[model samples]
Target: MMTTAVPAPAISVRGLEKSFDDLRVLRGVDLDIERGSIVALLGSNGAGKTTMVRILATLTRPDAGTVMVDGFDVMTDGANVRECISLTGQFAAVDQILTGRENLKLVAKLRHLDDPGGIADEFLARFDLVDAGSRRVAGYSGGMRRRLDIAMSLVGNPPVIFLDEPTTGLDPEARIEVWTMVQELATRGTTVLLTTQYLEEAEKLADRIAILHEGRIVANGTLAELKELLPPAEVEYVEKQPSLEDIFLALVGKNAPEGELR
Candidate 1:
């Protein structure tokens, strides 16, 4: 008789707990993210979203609980966990003095890739930064800098990536561009865990959504599943119209061809 093997989750958390002195940041949190899927950790500020990402990325140790990335225990196999994951925090980490190409090359070289130059060029083109690759990062627009930050994370092609509020502070068009890039990453088999404040962003990109409220996940599931948890909508007389976000985007396109707020 033949048997099938069950693949381990790309990311798994069990009874996760964290604290900063007397303040509890995460309270008995548990999560599981499957391979090649995108999971959005939605939360308000101080909701422990960044803390969870840090623990999973091996940057910080949790006070209690098990965290596994690609089947490796984060605590005991921190180095192995790091090998399988890349993290881009809330802010861009690129060096202002280095050209975009240089930033990619630096990451590639640090990871000891055989052909750093080739890898740099590949990411530059992939992230739509080839034209701006030679210019110092300081001169790059907010969108361009964010793209480069993500591009640098992909230098080693880790199977899992953590993006913490990746689209924050971007104009609408730039936010959409980053959202598109995130979808592309998941399509290519990278499991992505992103923290975001935007409900619309999660609805657009996530295979599953986990809402963290005051250090605990209040809801976790597919969009429809999560919606099921909400109270039934009250009957309305008027037909439903577009959301404010939709109306805002439409207006921006019409009133500002460049997509910038004056």
Candidate 2:
């Protein structure tokens, strides 16, 4: 008999549960995030999307279930898990008192990254923040601050990044900028786990999507798969006067009959 080795999931949760008093935030949620892929968690308010992200980031502990990040158990090896992950919450965490360059330097120093100055400068150039890097974060615009905050998260070059509503208050342009950065990160083989309320963002970036409804995953699959789970997937027909059927028809002619026009 030969034994096969299983490649570890970038992040994994099994029978995960979390409750605050009578309000259960998560109920036996299970998920596997593969290495170098982006997985988006989607849901309405109070859907436990952020809670699940927190658990994976090791900020919160589950009442029951096992979580592993980069093959380290989050419960017992949290420090190691932290070393393998980076998290940027909904709000930008840049210190207004510090210059953008200073902020990156701080994060680099804290992460014990070699040559903090060089690392900060590299990120400054990479994020196109070089000109603004010398300006105080307080003087920066929302997008600039957000970009700097994201730059800090990359100081250590962690393999897995958890981005929780990263585009929350960003304008459309800023959001698009962030999306490009995310694509670049994924291209470099970094695994990303993102939580977002914006459907477009998930549709555009997620390799897979999991929808949480009332503390449980109501659906999980690739964007196409989840779309298929809805109803009619494809249909072809010709229309001119724009009748109900014509309205239902798509320009591409592939109609997902299962999914509503959302």
Best by lDDT: 1
Instruction: Give the Cα lDDT of each candidate.
Output: 0.85, 0.83
lDDT of 2 by residue, 123-218 (tens): 999999999989999998878888888889988899999999999989999999999888888999999999997878887898987777667665
Model 1 lDDT per residue over 147-256, tens place: 99999998889999999999989999999999999999999999999999887898899998887766766667776665443334345755444442333233323441
Off by over 4 Å in 2: 1-6, 233-262
| Residue ranges of candidate 1 with Cα displaced over 4 Å | 1-3, 237-262
Estimated TM-score per prediction?
A: 0.89, 0.87
| Candidate 1 clashes between residue pairs 3 or more apart in a chain or in different chains | none
Q: Given candidate 2, what's the lDDT at residue 70?
A: 93
CA error at residue 43 for candidate 2, angstroms: 0.7
In terms of lDDT, the poorest run of 10 residues in model 2 is: 243-252
What's the lDDT for residue 190 in model 2? 93
RMSD of 2: 5.9
Q: Candidate 1 versus the native: TM-score?
A: 0.89
Per candidate, the number of residue pairs that clash is 0, 10
